[model samples]
Target: MSGQLEVLNKKLKQAIDTRKVLETARKQQVDTLTNFAAKLSLSCKGMDIELDNRLAKFRSALSKGVDFENLAPLIAEILSLLKNQEAQQLSHQRELHTSVLTAGKLLQKTKGLPDDTRRMLRHLLDHQLNEIQSTNDFIPILNKLVSIYNQALNVKLSVKNTEDSITQPRLAKELLTLANDLVFEDEAADNVKAIKNKISETDSVEDLLTSAIEIIRIVATNISDERQSAQSFLVSLNQTLEDLHHSIVATSKHSESMSTEFETLNKRIESKIVNLTKQTQDATSISSLKALVDNELKSLSHDLIAKERLEQEDRQALIKNFHDINTRVGSLESKLSKYKKRLHEQRFKSLLDGLTKLPNRAAFDERFNHEFHLFSVQESDFTLVVIDVDHFKSINDQYGHSAGDKTLQVIAKALQMSIRKSDFIARYGGEEFVLLMPGMSVEHATAPLEKLRQAIKSIPFKFKNKSVQITVSVGATQFKKGDTPLIAFDRADDALYKAKKSGRDKLCINS
Candidate 1:
């Protein structure tokens, strides 16, 4: 019996150890799986709706404590998405392979590329084909390369032409000019001005450092003051809302008081009338009855007179309160109107390109979303046209940023005039602009876009007494059924690439 007990104890210890080992392994796996899921989501969340939903569930389960039985199907789903993602990557890789090879070959043939430009190109091309992660990764690089190539071409052409380029002031002067325009608070403004003056006068490092420290401190204070000003606006608005609430509460309380008083008055009048009726009926003689009736009538008249006075007082109070409330409501409405106007102005500024005075990429996104949503419910389609200024960097290189800015503004105005009232145009970024044509197919859009192209080509651009011609390349695609925003954008972008490839200043419609 003792021997049997010892053997059972040993077996129990082994079982406990095995259970602990499993628990540790399970915890590690849960941690790892949760982390892996988040990593995957970073890359693939927007790729598919179903995959996103599945990832959410899997992550939720991991948080609760991972269950293999519940996770099995989810794991399968994630695996399926991974496979799909891999396949898409392979397709993108093939495209990258071709584009990169072409870029590399072009770089090899092209002469007079600057050291920095050459290095940038080599850095992009030296990556292994498999290391080409996504199509997005190479786009900006290609854009930069395109700009560089155009700059080189312009340089080569201008080698023979002896047109004197305009002398541009240093960027530092521009920064100082912009700084002077800023509304700085307290001593910061004075310090900044002093620094600007000192910069012009002395070369003492110690003096500069002391001034720099003082300026930094003052700037911090100024930023704080600016934040406080913004906060005060919110606080004032909140206080007004609170006042409105208090006014409503005061009205409700006044109403409740009046209701109680009215109820009391009704009960008192009713009780007195009942008592008088009984007393009159119980009178012993006519004289006694007359006296009793007169007394009761006088008493009731006194009560009515007192009540009338109270009611009149209440009515006057209520009127005053209503007038005050009306005034407050008017104030609130006026403030709200002012606030809305300010917000509108702020939003307009936020969505506008400062240089070109055109709606920026953020504005384009807003309009694109609206038009895309309209298509689904209203069965109305819109063509998304991407307009890229051809050899835009060349203009900047030959002239200056200020000249480029002026050129863009002129082009933007010209483009705006060319579009219909129903159509929308916005600066997409840099040298790219987008046009949205409502209830129009790409086929219908082509003619107007071509005219726009021609209009841009005809613009008389003269910088530093040298005539320079400017043109734009266009890409158009219709928003149709079974198209996501990403897919539609990709199609348009793809068309733009083709137009650029086929010697630019051309319009390609692929809808």
Candidate 2:
């Protein structure tokens, strides 16, 4: 029983020893795998950052978010495939090490073989050599291991040759070339076919390094090129914007200058109009005075002739006296007519507008009173329209006051054109105008007023070198029974005010 216990203790000791060896090997393998996985993880993470940066830059070119749903899965699949390949390589490396140990033991067993037996041993060794050479481990390490095995075999075979020594190095060189070609070909065969071909065909590790360096260089070059292109585009855009700004400024200046010219022209036209109206009034008054003077002269001549007949004895002396009185009366009559004509001419001239050849406010007032009384007495219906320019001050400020004046004149002309033969239109103030329509009610007046409004809106006024648009606010009212001219005018004025208040370039009618 003591001997049985001793055997059991020995078996337990052997089992403990075996477990220790297995634990050590497992620990080594675990450590290697951990280190390898850590390195690969770090490398893959770096690649991911680089790829993300590149993709971020690419995505920024689009206006919307990138659609990476399909692409994300593809990238994940690639990472999994790489992990599997790494695990297989590790397994193969362990297997290769075990095989090398086994081969070493076999060589040791054949150490004392005879020549014929040695040849057979050499064949077996060659087969093992082929197996080692075909491994997936690092080519240089695999080649070195195979060379060591060959050297050991050669020693046993008593074979010595300088030529054989060169063979392994040549094979190593070929294998290295093949490895490089395989990696490069795989990398180069991407979607960008031309770039792939260029990468594949390149020779030398330095060339590969240069190519890799060039990738970085190309990225830098692309960044620089993009910067330059962006700069150029910005410059061009700035130039275009600057040119547009200049054009707008020039156009604004031109409009202002034109407006000023038009205002001056309008003033001249108004002055001319005022003068012509005055002249016409003066001529009419002069004609009336001349008729009165002619009648007086005829009466005086007849009275003188009758007086001459009354004194027959002193007829010759009477006739001479009468003729003298008649001459003096005729001369006085002629002088009076001339003086009246001059006065009428002066009055007419005073009532005229120098710029527009139209009646001034004073002339309009005089005619309005006269016509108002006539219409009032006759019990005739008439409409009065007050037209005011809209945004006259703004037009002057933007285009210049000269343009404002031109706008007024253009509107005045349009009013004149729109009126009937019986209708009277006149400039009531600077930017205010008046139109009198006979036998028209406020409702009936709207058609003509709107027509006038549309006409003015349609007519383009050329002030200086610019064409300007203008509109008028009109207030119209019909004369009522027992209404004074002033009352009628006041109603029209209120309506005009309402039109301006509601909005400029619209019509308002006083009921």
Instruction: List the global CA lDDT of all models.
Output: 0.77, 0.63
Backbone collision count in every prediction? Answer: 0, 25
Cα-lDDT of candidate 2:
0.63
How well is each residue in 1-511 modelled by candidate 2, as lDDT tens digits? 9999999999999999999999999878766754564454445443345444433443342214334464465456555656665676568767866776576456546554456545644554456444544344336544645665575677655643444455433433333222222211233323223332334454444555545554455446645865886576566556655655655565556556655655665565566556555555666577775765565556555545544443342445445545655655565566557656855865675576533446777788998898789887887778888988887766755665345545665666777788888888877765778888887777888887898899988886766677777888999988888889899999999999999999788999997
**In model 1, which runs have C-alpha deviations exceeding 4 angstroms?**
1-230, 252-268, 376-381
lDDT for each residue of candidate 1 in 166-241, tens digit (9 for 90 to 100): 2112232333333333334356656676665554343344554565565567667866875886688788878877
**In angstroms, what RMSD does candidate 2 have relative to the true structure?**
41.9
Candidate 2: worst-modelled 10 consecutive residues by lDDT? 176-185
